[model samples]
Every structure is written in structure tokens, then in C-alpha cells.
Target: MANTSYTRSEELKEILSGQETQLQQKMDEAKDMASFLVELVDTLEVTMSNRSAKGDKEKPLRYCTHIMEQLDALGWDRVTLVDQDLSRVQIELCDASQRKHLITARFPPAYPTIPLTIAPLEVPECEDDQLASQRGLSVGGLSLKQGLALEAAIRQAEGQLEIFREFWDVMQDFDERTWVIDPEKPTRADKMRRCALGNHCSIQVTVQPLSPRSMPDTKLFGPTASIAPMRTKLYQNAGLWDVKKLPRENLEVLLELEGGFPSPVSTNKDDINVGCGICYSFRFEGQVPDQLCSHAKCQQPFHRVCLYETITTSAPKT
Candidate 1:
């Protein structure tokens, strides 16, 4: 009986040792799980902190500051106007001839990431499709369809200013040398110029922007008796037009005028400034009389509105 008790005691010791080993393994697993949980919490906290800091750094004020820095680099003098919001900016670009052109740029809310819209402040009133297509803004060798930074767009505009310099120079020569009757206030965008040629006669010419010295589309206004000679001379001398000469020079050679185009400063105001015969005022309702009587003897100038009113009222009972 004592031997049996010894065996049972040994079995009891073996069972207790196996249970202790299992308990130690369970404790170690719990420690490892606790360490894993602490690391996960730390990772989440760092991620959230970084995201909040990034959100604060990318606010609208930051965008405005970035834009101002770029404009300051481009020279503040070139910037003619800028709105308070920094959404719209007007920049004045000068050509090789010292002639200036104004361009307006509009930024979207997502600017720099999205391309800004750039357009000339004064676009031609009658732009042909070909010229219009060539005017698209190309920034830093990329089409405007792609994203453009502020500095790149400004630089591109500066280069483009040189392309139209000749055209503006020709128009300038016309204004300074001749008495321009139409477009009393001329802008860089004007492609047409009408000059008074004494005796109540005028000639309108539309210049080609790409080829400024080429023969322009010409139309003469006045009595046929007076215009017939000018028309015949223009056609006969069309081939004499010299591309190397200025527009005023070409016209003088083509029409064979007695005196060069009449100087606005030297000409008598009474002869050049013919008021509407109907209204008897130099300017009627802010409009100069552009229409003239078709008769050769009485080439009375009248405003379009005045002539229309007279014609409609004077019509015999239709």
C-alpha cells in the first residue's frame, strides 16, 4: 500500500509541472499582445498629427503669399493692376520698340495645379480666324491647355510682344502723319484706320496683322467724280507697293497725292471737322457724321440716324 501511494504522488507532481509550463506560455503571449497594441496607438497618433499640420499649411493665405512672391520676382513695375483677392492681375509688357501691351490673367481656385486664363486687354475688334488661332497663349513651351506657373506665363507674354511690334509701329506712323477721322481714340487693337484726304474725301484701310506692309483692303468715301481718279490710280499703281516702306509712304506713291496726307495739326479745323449738315453740329449725340450725300454738287455730310430719319419721313405715301 505504501508503494501505491508513492506512484500516485509522482503522477500528481508530473500533472502540476505540465500545467505550470502552459501558464508561463500564456503570460508571455499576453505581454506580446500588449506591446503590439501600444505600437499601434503610437502609429495612429503620429499619422493624425501630420495630417492636421499639413491642412494648416495649405490654407488660402499660403496660396496668396506664394502668388505675391512670384509677382515680386517678375518685377512689380510690370504689374499694372492686381485685385485684392489675387484672382485677377493685369500685366503691362513692352516690346523691343518700347511699345506696351496689356494682358489680363485670371486664376482659378486651384491655380498652379490648373492653368490660368491669359488674354490681351485690348483684342482686335475684327480678328480673323487665322489670327485668332495664333493668339493662343503658350507658356514655357507648353500649350495653355496644360498647367502654367505664373512666372512662365509672364515670360511667354514678353516674348510674344515682339511679334506684333511692327504692326503697332505702322499704325503709329499713320496716326502721327495723317488726320485720322475714324477711331478718334485709337488702341493697340485697332487694325483699321480711316484718314481724311481733304475735300470731304476719306480713305479707309484695313491692315494685315501678320503682313503689315502688304497691300491693305482699301475703300474710298466721297463723290464718285472725286473717287474715280483715286481708284484708277490705286489699281494702276498697286504693283508699285513696296514692302520695305512704311504704310504712309506706300499710300503716297500709290495715289500720287499733291501734298502728302494732310497733317492733323496744320489743317484748318473748319474744313476737316465738317458737322452733320442736318444737325448742324460737329458731334451729334456723341457721333460724327460718317455718311455723305451721294450727289456730286451737294456732297452734304449727314449722320446715319439723321439720314435714315429724313429718308423714312420724306418718303411719298407708300
Candidate 2:
């Protein structure tokens, strides 16, 4: 009986020890799972926070608004952000009619030191026969937010004073008074009359250049044959030669200087070489009528038959 009791007690001890070992293992596994879950939650939270942080939307919005206000203060009607980079923002400024002007703002990669570049979106046309000039900016490594802010500040401040000076020559105005011809004969008596009239005198003048002959290939000799003699005589008569005033009327001669008249019966009908009002070439000998042009400058003096052919061929097409 005594032995039986002792054996039963030993068996009970062994069973209890086995159960305690199993419980410890289960607690360790649960702890490990809880730690893993905590780590996963932390990583997820960080990622979500980053997505909605101020840097993503708030920073860009803030910078853009500041820039826009600056542009408005500088008399700009509209501004748009076309592109953004680490060190620059490409902006387009527009007027009421939607004409755009491009500008760039440069900033440091670390930010704060903002600079600007501005240029017209459309190329300025050369006016008054002047050459077209280009203007604009450059940048360094800068954040988009910094660049936007910088650009706005630049436009609002003293940057608007920038001007582009063209290196082109100034167009000369056409003179008419001194360049005109006098039709009336000048005599020593006319000179005396002009001197007496002085400031109150107005002479009759023509803008035409006198021709020595009515036909081409006519020889013009001496200063008298040229306009020089006529100008000299008129100046002496007017008593205003010292002033040598110029005329204001636009003057141009339609006559073209050619080598000679076209041959009446040239063998080559395929082509003809002739000079026009300006230094331009015209080629139409054996082509269809539709290929020819009938501008006054294009019509070179030709033989009667050639002229007829040209008219006949082109008239049908017209």
C-alpha cells in the first residue's frame, strides 16, 4: 500500500512538470507574434504619414500661392506652373489675351537663396528694320518649392526693370525735300528771289528722278545728264543749298537696269536671262501657262511674239 501511494505521487509530479513546459512554450510564441505585429504597425504608420505629410501637398501649395501673389503685384495678369524640379520652377506668365511669357526661378538645393530667369515666350519681331533680340534666365540645384518662391519674389521686386537693348542699326527715315527735283527753270534772278523770301519761302518740288531718255540703253553723259546738275542748279537758285533739306515723300523708281533688250528671234526658247526691278531672276520660256506669274516686276521686256506667247499661255489659266 505504501509503495503504491509513493509511485502515484511521482507520476503526478511528472505530469505537472510536462504541462508547465508546454505552457512556457505557448507564452514565448505569443510574445514573438505580438512583437512582430507591433513592428508591422510601426512601418505601416510611418509610410501613411509620409504620404500625407506637409511636404507632399502643403509645401507646393504654399510656395505656389506666394509666387502668384508676387506676380500679381508686379502687374502680371496670370501665371501658371508648367514644370517643377529640384532647383527650378518653369512658369508661364500670360496677359489678358493669353499671350504667354516664360520665366524660371533658380534656387539652391538646400534652398533659401533664390534667383530668377525671365524671357518672353514669343520671339519679338524686329521693328523699324531692327534686328530681333533675345532675353531670359538660368538656375542651379534647387527644390521646386524654393524655386517657386524665389521666382515670385524676383518678379515682384526689382527684376521687372530688366531691359534688352538691341545691337541692330537704327532704320534711317526716307528724305523727300532735299531729294526732290524742281521742274521750274532756275536763274540768277530766282536765287535773289529765294534769298529775299528766306524762311517764308516754299518751293514747288517733285519726287520723280529725271530720266535722260525714254528708252533703255540710252547713253547719259555729264553732270547735266544726271540728277546732280539739276539738284545743283535748284539749290543755287533756292539759296538754301547750305541747309540741304531732305524731302519727306516716299520715292522709288520702277525702271530696272538691264544688260540689253531681249533678242527678237533667239533660238533658245527654253530659258531667258533678264534683270528685273530688283536683283531677282525670272524663268518661264517653255512651260505651261499656269506656271507663270504676271507681276509687273516679273514682266521683262521681250519680243512681240514672246510677249504674246506669255500672255496667251498664262491668260487661259487665269
C-alpha RMSD by candidate, in order: 18.1, 25.9
Model 2 agreement with the true structure over 110-199: per-residue lDDT tens digits: 223223434322221223222111222211111122334443544432232122111000001111112111112332111100100011
Candidate 1 residue-wise lDDT, 123-185, digit = tens: 344345555457653222213322467778878767656666788889999999888877778
| Best model number under TM-score | 1
Q: Against the hidden reference, what TM-scores do the models get?
A: 0.70, 0.21
| Per-candidate total of colliding backbone pairs | 0, 11
With a 3 Å backbone cut-off (N, CA, C), the pairs that clash in candidate 1 are none
Report the lDDT of model 2 for residue 142.
Answer: 12
Candidate 2 has its poorest 10 consecutive residues by lDDT at 191-200
